[model samples]
Target: MFAPRVALASLSGESDADWAKACEHPAGAAFLGGVALDEPTREAARAMVDRDRDEFLPEDPVEFVDDQLSALDDAFLRAGVNVRTVDLDPLREVTEVCASHDAVLEVNAHCRQDEMCAAGAGESLLRDTARLCEQVETASDAGAAISVKVRAELPDVHLPTLAQAVERAGADAIHVDAMDSRRVVRDVSDATDLFVVANNGVRTREDVFEYLSYGADAVSVGRPSRDPEKVRAVYAAVKEWFL
Candidate 1:
């Protein structure tokens, strides 16, 4: 019921003010993402974000990440950010935890973090299809809108299979990371049936519109603060740009 025409460029670290701004895009209906994970610099990052939005610590992602992700999901949803959840084993813990908090869950296969992948998360899902599908069904059964975040690189990445599998898994949407290129989007279109929420490297309204041209349901903001003063400025400009 939100911006079927426009969406924001979302990422790991975002603010409620960011969500407020992204939604103001006359074209934007809602935002995606549940703030950033506990990065290597949690304290420093925490200071940069609004106190209410989820922020993580600087350490090897431990089981503690599961609770952090759950807490973030709950916090953002209450703040009205349409928070999307991510965790180590989206199948093992994130799905249920997100559902408990009434938040959306995504299988984050697009994470490029080396430490994440080494721990059997992130892009690791792309390696074993059999396991991935099982996990997809698991998340889908939990009542969370399942999504798969991928680079949308073809030949190099099996986005089509991943997309179909995600759909079969009962996902409500697919979050495509286009890496600032339209070709990447075409690849995702070829794979899934669910609506698209385009992401990654978006710096302008034109890029947002470009995704709309390809049937993307919405876009996410990569770097806009939820600060009251600046957030609305960016949202207002984008609103005018698309309308």
Candidate 2:
């Protein structure tokens, strides 16, 4: 899991510069991006892919991904912070790159974009729990520390059941974007031994503490991460709590 308890959540357009900046912060870990693994996956993310999107990695997806991951590994090596990459792709493709780079492989099931859903990749996977579990198992079998990121409020998606499925599939962690429902985090935590990461709207020490108190092993910051001060505040809050 992470130390300090605060993680920089996967932002759409996070750049190398963004990674560098986050490296200097006190957050326990930095999730690089929800990048696309192939042309199809990239196409599925088209609507959200802007110049700022992490999907803008390289012209050749695999090479570019490998290179970027290596760069992150180098950059964060001395910082003692974990580098995790989130991506939308088949399990095989994702596990290959993550294994090569020695980075954590997080499956992206939290995105609700229409394009992604149409591709049967993002939130669409929620309705297909079997597929999601398969992805986690595939990644885990490939020697990667697997993280399954899911949205808590998806229709008909039972948070605890999904968490148990992910755990049974060998996922090392469950990243929950628990929108307004701390109960989702609590339920998932109670259902499995997987490291629980609570995400969304976490801006202050109080927010971090609230999630942790609800059984999250770590808390993540998303939109608020655009501001370095907020990231710092979150880091300080986590640090203070640990002290």
Candidate 3:
């Protein structure tokens, strides 16, 4: 989906400036959102959007989402950046918005937050493989190049099995938050034809190379992207290694 082999993973507080910084880098792709699709997911997005406060009280959920998407579109979409929006909602609700904006739709199954999991929207999906596959198929059917972002190490969840299921369900790519287990990326890559994007704990060029060596088609930088200089360093390292 991206020309470079490096990507900026979805992070909190992804403002227009954040997207611009990512575009300034040579990273292959930049993923925005991790936005809530429903009440369950909304709680988490509320926390991020209303940080420093203990509670989130929105008068209208629909308007809240519309406003959020509008602000994001205004800030980042026009930049011509290859951006994808990660969402916690079902495919049917989020697909059209993505298509309307020409943004790639990424289904998030990697979040470990209690609220999201309780709502059956995040890591909880890992255990519900059937439903996860259904979501991917729905997005793909809607003509979006779908990507499923999954977390590794979920109890009773097999990375390869999930990866293959998503691939068979028509997902274009699988973004794995390997979480200390690079083997998950390797196994997922080996098990599916879908493009594999490896995430977690990537700090240096060597970290990027290590994931690629482990069979990741792309490596994602998360926390590091908060610092433009660090992102630039990674971009420089990737260029040196790949070019």
lDDT-superior candidate, 2 or 3: 2
Point out the worst 10-residue segment of candidate 2 by lDDT: 77-86
**Over the stretch 1-243, how does candidate 2's per-residue lDDT look in tens digits?**
656677777766564435645544566666666666655566765655552334553566556556666666654421111222224244566577777766677888777777767777778888888888877887788776778888887769998998899899998888899987877898899889999989988986788888888898888777776777887888787777767
RMSD of 1: 6.8
lDDT of each residue in 56-171, candidate 3, tens digit only: 23454334434544544644222111111224244455565555655567777887766567767778888988888887888777775778888887769999988889999988
Give lDDT per model, in order. Answer: 0.52, 0.71, 0.67
How far residue 189's Cα lies from its native spot in candidate 1, in Å, is 2.4
Candidates 1 and 2: which is better by lDDT?
A: 2
TM-score of 2: 0.87
TM-score of 1: 0.64
Worst 10 residues of 1 by lDDT: 76-85
Error at 214, model 1, angstroms: 1.1
Shift of residue 33 alpha carbon in model 1, Å: 6.9
For all predictions, the C-alpha RMSD in Å is 6.8, 3.5, 4.4
For model 2 the local lDDT of residue 123 reads 83
Assess candidate 3 and give its lDDT: 0.67
lDDT value, residue 236 of candidate 2: 81
* Leading candidate by lDDT: 2
